[model samples]
Target: MKKSISITLCAALLALSGCSQNTSSDALSSDISSAASESQSTASQEESSGSSLQNGNGGFKVEGTKLLDANGKEFIMRGINHAHTWYLDEDTTAIKAIAETGSNVVRVVCSDGEQWTKDTENMLETVINLCIDNEMIAVVEVHDATGKDDKTALDKATDYWIEMKNALIGKEQYVILNIANEWTGGWNGELWRDGYTESIPKLREAGIKNTILVDAAGWGQYAKSIGDYGKEVFDSDPDKNTMFAVHMYGTAGKNSSVIEKNLKYAIDNGLCVIVGEFGYTHTDGDVDEAFIMKYCQENGIGYIGWSWKGNSGGVEYLDIANSWDGSVLSADWGENLVNGENGIKQTSVKCSVFTKE
Candidate 1:
């Protein structure tokens, strides 16, 4: 769902440095810049692999800019985001409903207690198993860091993932650990770069090896940051299994040229990326959802819509389904996103791991 901040402020400040729910200080930026620059050479030395890295371990791995499933087949995500933390009761049925749409993935929202109720390890395990049972890959993410520049909060979210090792480990074949959703509200690339560059190693050291997914700065709308320093973050992982994601709202998706340029910047740089979250219309402005889907489909890039249900705070329209059971699909947003041209139904292909040999 679109952030629940003041849209008026966002709209007024849209042209100037873009709109972010929070702001960062120059002192913080300077400190991060110094720390992040120290690892520049080391990250640059690690080249992107051109061959599949699956290794028969039954886990998703990155080869260049492509995401290969456990079977070593390229898997392009086409799915929707589910607010599982906000609507925990819906998990058992919601996941099954989402799978019925022919989606190949589902980005499940979890909380680290920074802003919402913390989802315990048991709850996370349940959500993950539900996706696997339905044959859909689960992209689990912590939502507390959305649109915030506080490194402590970001680190706390990271800690949450490390603590969930019991639930995440050994499920690499079925899970993607999205570090945080829309972290670092400011447009400072160095902050986004340094923060993740520092955090990636912590996760790897702690033994959470699922392909880590990192969102762009400026509320996940700033793709230029990924293009500028994404390689550094990607290389920070000893496993070289990190993937970048950009959330498309009005700021980044207002037009076709902006959308294509943002996406191509990372792709051209040999980085694996995906549209982690997007909506047709947003508080910032109207989004070119059609072009987003069309471009991703044409290029073998992956995309997931904003949400399945449970949107509020003046952004309820973003909900794709009117009911948790998915019995009634919202007229335009839900229907078009799922069944319309270049939508998930037409483009999503189940990962080979789910098919019988």
Candidate 2:
């Protein structure tokens, strides 16, 4: 399900007044600063899309905190997450510039097949160029409003993801498929249990050998139940490529207890875990991002920020005046404010805690 209206969060997300930072932002100025070339030789596009998940050599291995290249090199993915805006925007020089900033990967958002129009495919093809030009990896995802643990929905979404994945098969050699965005099935456990198991095989059979990311049920709000199932499915497969994902909404969970427990169990069981999403929300009094980031770094877990709209998701909500925005990161942390707006652009090509620290 999709809606065009503004989404004010429940009490947890609604406590925005405390958002340390406040300001209108053309936060993506970096993206706008420099533009990418729309001109790519047809042959180059064909070659990249032809490349497979399996790298030069077969039998993929783990990379530094993320999936390894097929050749067994520990993959270090520096990247961004594009939750929306594809079909509508045909030209994205800023996107390529994002890759240039040193992000080795990007997570592209997708709705179930219902939203895949001819335009979407074209935009996706261009994204392939952005990834290829920057030598970055790609993560494709499904975004449903009220995602249930329904097979029909999962299949449709998976199909949509594959179409994008398949198109880039040869184009970008390093693309991963994320099962769904957060996975909220009204907190129904059994339904999730049955649905995920079935969906995995379907994706695998499609030649999607890239390690897939599965989310904790309840939009990653309930790690206990979601973690339990993650281990079960993982243990059953006997493979090391998959990872269990959780979305971190500061105070959204009962406590850090949920995250702490999930991390411990995933480690003990030898299954990989990642904080697929989290932002500046004051989910807990502390904002909790450092915990998740710190834990991931210490434990070899991978993390992709909730977003990179001028890095505004965190900065804007924190009320940090983006030095560039001058005013501040805009209040529309999760929504779009302007389409035609353009100015100062992304100058940096790479980002990460390891680098910053």
lDDT of 1 by residue, 1-357 (tens): 333522111332445222001323343344767658745633553332222242333588877788888777789999999989988888988999999999999999899987888999999999999999999999999988887788987899999999988898999889999988888777889999989999999998998889889998888888889889999999899888888888887878778988898887689888899998888887888889999999999998999998898887788888899998899999879998999999999999998888874
Q: Which ten residues in a row have the lowest lDDT in candidate 2?
A: 335-344
Model 1: runs farther than 4 Å from truth? 1-53
Q: Write out the backbone clash pairs for model 1.
A: none
Question: Which TM-score value belongs to model 2?
Answer: 0.65
The TM-score leader among the candidates is: 1
Residue-level lDDT tens digits of model 2 in 238-357:
344566665556543234554566555555555566666555454343345545555555555555554544333233353212322223334443221111111112111222211322
Which stretches of candidate 2 lie above 4 Å from their native place?
A: 1-66, 76-78, 86-91, 113-120, 162-165, 235-240, 252-258, 282-286, 310-357
- The TM-score values for the models, in the order shown, are 0.87, 0.65
Cα RMSD for candidates in order: 11.3, 15.4
